[model samples]
Target: MITLKNVTLRRSAKVLLDNASVTLNPGEKVGLVGRNGAGKSSLFALLNGTLHEDGGDYYIPAQWRMGQVAQEMPETDQSATDFVVEGDTTLVAAQAEVRAAEATDDFERMAHAYMELHDAGAHDAPARAQALILGLGFKTTELTNPVNSFSGGWRMRLQLARALMCPSDLLLLDEPTNHLDLDALVWLEAWLKRYEGTLVVISHDREFLDAVTNVTLHIDAGKLVRYGGNYSKFEDMRAEQMELQQAAFGKQQDKIAHLQKFIDRFKAKASKAKQAQSRVKALERMEKIAPMLADADFSFEFKEPANLPNPMLSMSGASFGYPPPEDAPAGTPPTVIVQHVNRSVLAGQRIGILGANGQGKSTLVKTVARALAPIGGELTEGKGLNIGYFAQQELDVLRPLDTPLEHMIRLVRETAARGQNHGQGTREQDLRSFLGMFNFGGDMVKQAVGSMSGGEKARLVLCMIVWQRPNLLLLDEPTNHLDLATREALSMALNEFEGTVMLVSHDRALLRAVCDEFWLVTRGGVEPFDGDLDDYQRYLLDEAKRQRESLKESLKEPVAATTKIAESEAPKGATGTFSLKNAPAQRKLDAQRRQQHADKARPIKRELEGCERRMAELTQEKARIEAQLATPLAPAAIAETGKRLKAVGDELHALEERWLELTEEIEHTAGA
Candidate 1:
């Protein structure tokens, strides 16, 4: 167990933790959550003994080993596998001792060294390291590649793998999922589930926290607060606490108001002078309750477009990827990721784009946003279309040396230059006010973007996007650098926006809150996902299992073939050949079997199609009813519509279940 009693921690002259205390028991998985710069990292530092409390006591068992991901970017030519394997320092030391003992020709020392190596499990270290690498999304072929050959994000994965490879009693991971794709994130979640050691992870992803954590450690207002259960439970408990606190504060304020009113009414009268003085004394002595501070200081909305085009954009027979080389031969074709995609973006549509990394989610967004041209076919924009695009890489659009004010001003000038406002000028003061709306006020507006934190830079990018008054938004991983509060604020703003949104994000909460539909990009095709996030999760798990089974089958092919040959050569009737006399009968029997299966499946297939059509109709009706509810409607009409919508939803659910059953039945019959 680890305990911090009255711990007051500070960096420079600023206090991060003020008399805050929390205890962590053995084998507990804790999620440390707070705003950016709220001392979550500082707490990790204290736990690792790199930083100490400014006051009071902090204790950890001396025998316990700790492992944490390194923050510095690695620059090494060493093979990736070797680098991760080196994380097992005990194993490395034991191997070194064995070598030394052998060089000295000391039999007794060599025997002890061999036993130490066995205890450290040095023999299987390579396999363990490789497994960690694979789980972190590296291919088997890349295991022996030089670490320096990989990109920064891949290197960060290596760092995470290295941390995981270490043998320790406690493991600390900070923002471990930031550089990971959904596949890797899912794998990491499973890996963390099987881990036996005590774990503390800092993450802004709520779904991830709920999946992996048994406890929540929330740092707020310079206090370390511990809550049982996961992030969702913590949210529930916090909301209830806030409700009680607000009620008490309201009651206290009423009492103070009553006392003040009495004092003001009769303080000048001689009979009430003593009482008024006593009231003033009492007021002075009474403790004040501070107003509750909101979780986020910022909120923003997309400016409504002047025109709402029915079809905001359309892609017909389009291929998304980079342009071909100009100097290539005439027959050289453009490299495409997703080909022959036909999609339409309608007014007020909220579409979430999902895929594994490098599967063209960003490519599709870039092509639609006109940051990259379509490799083939046409992408037509509706008349009066205005697009707002948020890139996943903040630095790609942000000039590091420029301030937030400069970025907004440039946007205004660009809009004017493009004749977007018909030569209407945008003033610097207006830009400053717009920036201030994003929490970039006072001197902060003039602060250089290079000096700003990742969250600040991300906010600046978003502020610029919102200022464009675009009806269609293309966002790629917009929540990457945002804190939980900012993410909540963004989610709220997205929900309220009237514009069409096409977002690519790993944040499940954002997707669930904002997206009306989901599109899947995989295997050179883009198609609609018929279900929700839960369905998508199950699909990923099933896909992973299938891939593993395929690999196993491929590995067994040679041995299985050798066994078949042996059986064929040794045993009578082990293998049979079709005789000419029976060939006609066998063909007739095969045709009968095929016809029987087709007869069994044809009605199911037809019913499945019918169910799909009905499901689509119900979905559209539900959306229409929701839109009506959002408008000004009579209370009776609203109630009636709500009931109808519920009925439609229930029917849709039943239809979906039937559809799944039909699909499975058809597939099973065909395979048979």
Candidate 2:
């Protein structure tokens, strides 16, 4: 267990935690959450021993090993697998000792070193490291690639894999899912679930917190508060506490008001002057209860599009991929990823693009966004179509040296150049105000984009996107850097949006909240996915299992072939076991078994489809109720509506769980 008692921490002159205390038990998974710069990272630094508390006691077991993702990009030429294997210092040391003992011809030392290596699992370290790397979205062929060859984001993934490879009692991960795709994020969630260690993770992804964390440690107002459950439960508990606090504050205000009235009425009279003075003293003596501070409420809406064109875009036999390499032969063709992708994006459609990393989800998005052209086929945009594309890489759209105000100014100028506007001229003051809506105000608007945090940059990009008032939004990982508040704000805006949205995000909460349907990009093709995020997850797991089985079969083929040749070379009378000739029959039987399993799952699939349809209806109804609740109504009407909303919400939640269970059942039946 680790404990911090009366810990006072400060950075320079700014106090982050004032006598804060919290305890984390061993093997506990805690989510560290707060607004940016609320000292979440500072507290992490304190735990990692990089920073000391100004005044308090901190305790952790002395011998326990701690592991954390390295922030610095590795700049080495070492193979990726070797770099990950180096995370296990004990194994590396044991291997080194074994090498030294062998070189010196010391039999006793060599024996001891070999035993140490065995205990440390040194022989299997490469395979374990490879597994971690693969789980983090690295290709198997890239295992032998040089570390320095990877880009910054991939290097960060390598760092995460290295941290996971480390044998530690305490693991610290700060936004580990930031650079990962949905497939990798799902894999990481499962890996963390099985991790037998204490985990402290800082993440803005709410679904991730709910899936992996059992405790939530919130930093607010320079104070540390520990909640007993995950992020959702923490929110509920916090809301209840705020409600009680608000009640106490209201009571305190009422008492103060009555006392003030009595004092005003009596203080002027000589007979009751003493009594009035007593009242004044009592008022002064009473301890004031502060009103509960609400979380920052950020709400913004995209301006109605100038045109709502049905079928915003259509592709015919479109091939989406990168352009041909500069050094390629003169007639070389562009490398196509997704081919024969004939699809129509309709107005008001919310489509989530799903795929593994490097599987061309981004490619499809780019093609639709017109950042990249279709290589072999035509992509037709509707008349008056305007696209607001948010790239996964912030820097791809944002200028580093420019300030927020400057970025907005450029956007307005570009809009004016394109002769598209709301008739009101874009003024400098208006641009500043627009930036302010995204939380950029005062000096923040003037701050260089290069110096801004990832969340800030993302917000700037969003602000620019919304300013365009495009009819269709092509968002690729738009919430990657947003905090919970900003994400909620975006979700609300998207929900209220009348335009179409095509989103590719690893944030499951955002996807579930915004996307009405999903498109799966895989194996050089794109098609509609007839399921939700839960179903997609199950598909990924099933696909991984299939790949493992395929690899095993491939590995056995050569041995089987060698055995067949040997049997043929044997005497005719020799005992011939069930031969390779039966392999085709076995495969046929396996296919039959698969077909049987599918037949068994047919009813369950039908039930899941019904559940999904009901869920959609209930979701829309709940949204309608919520919108009604937000309006001004009589107290009785409001109460009735609120009760109905709660009932609907409960039913919706139950249906969602049922949908997940049904998906799992179908998956299990199929796999079996």
List residue ranges in candidate 1 displaced over 4 A. 247-295, 324-333, 422-425, 558-672
Candidate 2 ranges beyond 4 A from true positions: 99-111, 247-294, 423-425, 558-672
TM-score of each: 0.76, 0.76
Candidate 2 TM-score versus the reference: 0.76
At residue 77, candidate 2 shows an lDDT of: 98
**lDDT of all predictions, in order shown?**
0.78, 0.79
Reference-based lDDT, residue 40, model 1: 95
- Which pairs clash in model 1? none
Root-mean-square deviation per candidate: 21.9, 22.2
Full-model lDDT, candidate 2: 0.79
1-672: candidate 2 lDDT, tens digit per residue: 999999999999999999999999999999999888899999999989999999989999999999999999899999898899899978888778866865864555655565566568754577789899998888765777899999999999999999998899999999999999988999999999999999999999988999999999999999899999998778777756765766654655654454344334433432333222333332232212111112344657788899989889988988989988899889988888989988999998878899998889998888888788888888988998999999999999988998988887888888889888854348898888878888899999999999998888988888888888989999999988888778866865775578999999998777765676788999899998877777788999999999777544423342333333334443343355544555776557655665676576678767877887887888788678757756777655654564465467557656755664565565456445
lDDT of 1 by residue, 158-234 (tens): 99999998888999998998999888889999999998989999998988999999999999989999999998778
Q: List the residue pairs that clash in candidate 2.
A: none
